[model samples]
Target: MRYKGTKAGAIVVAAVTGSVVLAGCGDGSGSQVEGGGASPSASRSADAQEQGTTEVRAAYEKTAEAESARMTIKMNLAAAGKRITSDGEGVLDLATGDSVMTITAQDKTIEQRVVDQVLYQKVPGQNAPSGKPWIKIDLEKVAGQQGLSNQQIGDPAQTAAYAKAITDKDVTKVGTENVGGVSTTHYKVSVDVSKLPGGEQMSQQLGPTLPMQVWLDDEGRLRRQQIDLTVKAPASASAKPEGSASAQQLKMSTVMQFSDFGTEVNAEAPPADQVADMTDKALQGSRQQS
Candidate 1:
């Protein structure tokens, strides 16, 4: 199996969701906003000044915090003339810089923990041996179950790295829009992904450049963001590389939706009593194997 299934698994677990604004520096002859002969950069600076960087940053922080709370994400994957729908709830731990997601479908349950740039999936009946640096989660086996490889989960440090990428760039007010019935300010930010520390890695994952339109509420929380992701996959890889005639080109448009703010429930710690049952199950399964 090609392992495209890993995408779905990772999406289910680590929906923990960037920042920055950049200015178009190519030409000084760009269209002016309200002021005469003003570049896009000038316009953005004016807006930020009107809002005050301190206030804007505060708003961004509040929104970021709110967004990190309880969220229900619905993922729909369409491929090979088949569509699969998965629903999951996630709690973002800003303190530990991690996200815990639990998703259940039919009789299968998957609990995923994304921490320190690694994604771990614990199946209902399988227990990994303790103290492993990282256990490779077989995404193929967990296609409809739950799992993620290190590469697919992404690095947490990259998140902060990307945030700093466009810190000095300008943010233009793109007007107001309503999301989930909440009025929000839309900002058009131009960020150079190649400038950040992990920019190369993110660019590889997203392919080339990434342009995003971010929406924020009056409180400065991110309501939604839309990025046009263009990924180039080889033809043979896109199809099924038989006899290696080079990879085919494949393109997909991904729209990631975020919603249900301020709904994060408190983290439910695992019960101490449950450990004995899990250990017994693991031992029993191991004996059966022997």
Candidate 2:
């Protein structure tokens, strides 16, 4: 999905930080821990005990497998000490042939639409060229092409990838926090950006390491996430003769909180022709401006 213009740049910056934070926090491996100063037989017994405990923990962490729900997320972003906050509400309907997430937000009386999984700021007095101004993603198509379901968050195969990316030693439990009245475990996880799918380019453009914190509910579903990020200003821009004094570092923080989640087993899908028409109108509007 693409968002154009100045607003797009700002939204992208915030969204990228939010995405990284979520991905980093939710990636961890479930591994057995060995006890110290135990005899060989005793060690075997200890291993078994530890294994059982791990299984119990894992069971508690399993999230519900429902395919749809209404969700509300509030995000607060701070960059160089300046802050911006926004709240979004959406319905995630996955039971339909295609998974659809429709989100809308208002900054006072002005309502903005989020389309195709991308956020867009509605211009005042200007109607959306298309009836719909939100970004849409076809989850069924994505899963069919990728051979995985959205419900595979707890699948062994999927967890293996998260496990490999996250070392057991890298997960540091930071006690517990209350989220929506639920006491959840908080963990700080560090990932080697070099190990991710687009780590190389990301490291070059963003950085080498990404640090995130996650709050996990009793059922192991991620309830909240936060990330510290740094995106460097392009050298050419920073070096401009008329530019402000150069700073070697730029720091930003982003957060996403998930709530009111459940399966929407009977939600209806938006018709294909409607999606096509809206998309075409939006595209034509963009081209006219260009």
Candidate 1 lDDT, tens digit per residue, 1-290? 11233343443343223221111111111222211223345676655644532223333345445535554444554433334456666766433335667765434566765555334555566444453222233222221111122322333333333343343233456778997788987765545556555456545444555566666677666566554433333221234453343422223323333466555544443443332122233223222321
Which 10-residue window in model 2 sums to the lowest lDDT? 139-148
What is the Cα-based lDDT of residue 210 in candidate 2? 66
> Candidate 1, residue 286: CA error in Å?
29
lDDT tens digits by residue: candidate 2, 185-238:
777766566655544554643566667776777776656667676654434323
lDDT values for all models: 0.42, 0.42
Error of 1 at 182 (Å): 2.9
What's the distance in Å from true for residue 123, model 1? 6.8
For model 1 the TM-score comes to 0.52
lDDT of 1: 0.42
All candidates: TM-score: 0.52, 0.54
